[model samples]
Target: MRFALNHIAAPNLSLPDFFTAAGELGVTAVEIRNDLPDVLSAWDPAQVKAEAEEAGVTIVSINALYPFNVWGGDLPARAEAMADYAAACGAKALVMCPLNDGTKVSFDSLVGALAAMKTILDTRGLTGLVEPLGFPISSLRTKAEAIRAIKAAGGEGTYRLMHDTFHHHLAGETEFFPDWTWLVHISGVTDPDVAVDAMLDAHRVLVDDADRLENVAQIRALLDAGYDGPFSFEPFASKVHDAADPKGALKTSMAFVSAQL
Candidate 1:
């Protein structure tokens, strides 16, 4: 299992401490974020690159540029800024998320957005990991839809899918796109009372015996289908963020998931 950690796993930690935690967990790959802890605002790209080098950890990605499927407004500018920051920080990719406000964005708009973003990504030698948010209100909710848009935009080499297990369940998608996927975000929802559609980021937590998201099964399926990539932890619950020992909790969860496989 190639395990990676997102800074959301411990939003309280500073970038230096986050990299140390990843090393302690025996993981060489990690994903940083522009939200939550917001490492981008706290440190310069040179500092990020230097710290990552000192820690001997790879900055797999910057967590995201949101509402990226809407090609206009400040999105074009934001995308370039993010891509520039990602390149400067030595991050390998930039995660791109679509509009999740329950509004309809046309297919033409989606493809157009990808085509525009591809240029920004291509110029910086970065891969855009297009992640579909599976919220019922989300404009894009499945890997299949993302792939179709990517292909329509002629973004075959410049883009890849972010196969998020939580979103996969929420979207009710039965098909897997292992070949098109380059990264996987894993988290669990342990609240048994909440209906599937009602689950949100607040409900996400570390994977455990009580997890209802079928993370283990999802991981097995992806791996068996030849998706050789890192499964990065991305829990967004307040409880996880407030944990006194986030690394310890993550280690336990990692052990549980590994044992299951």
Candidate 2:
């Protein structure tokens, strides 16, 4: 299994440092975030691309365009700008997230949004990684639903799904689509009493032996089922940042995941 580093893993680290660490850890691919420090969001696109090239790292994907299904006045422009920036930053894909909160968006709306986004992505030779958030308030809650939307949008060749283990569990989705999946986000939740509806991204953490979410097993199953995409670490838990040695912790986690594979 190949490992890809997520920007959330070391949000405090500078872009150079993050890439350096990733390279040192034998990680060739990385996921950049619009919210992370010293990323394309803050730097010039040319410089960001140069820096990534100098660091010898390939950007796997952009973290996300949140509530992407809710296309409105500025949203279409913003999504287009983000897609351009992602392309300039040497990113292969843009992660598109679904709508959340109380607002109701029909599957038809999602299909429309995805079709529009696909046009933008295709123009720039980029792939759209459609991620279905499993939160109760989220409009898109399952990989199956995402697949359906992709088909409805006629995005079979332009878009791919992101199978996030945490969201998969929260959505209670048991189906897997290895062939259509572009990447897999791996993070475990340890809280036992946490309700699925209440599960937040902040609870994401490194996979541990006692993790209740079965992240390792799920990843193993994905691989066994013929998933050849990068398995990215996307822990949002604050403990990782507070650790005495975050890189050391990451190395340990990598070892654990390697053993599981």
Q: In terms of lDDT, which candidate is strongest?
A: 1
What local lDDT does model 2 show for residue 250? 83
lDDT of each: 0.94, 0.86
Clashing pairs in 2: none
Per-residue lDDT of candidate 2, residues 1-261 (tens digit): 999999888888878888888999888899998875437567777777887898899998987888889877788998988889988889999999887886789988898898888889999999999999898888899999888889998999999999999999999998889999989998888888887778898888888776777788888888889999998889888887566676787888889878876
Model 2 ranges off by over 4 Å: none
By summed lDDT, the worst window of 10 consecutive residues in model 2 runs over 35-44
Q: Candidate 1's residue-wise lDDT over 1-261, tens digit each?
A: 799999999989999999999999999999999888888888899999999999999999998899999888898888898999999999999999999988999999999999999999999999999999999999999999899999999999999999999999999998999999999999999998999999999999999999998999999999999999999999999999999999999999999999999
TM-score, structure 1 vs. true? 0.99
| Off by more than 4 A, model 1 | none
Model 2 CA lDDT for position 70: 81
Candidate 1 C-alpha error for residue 118, in Å: 0.5
Could you tell me the TM-score of candidate 2?
0.96
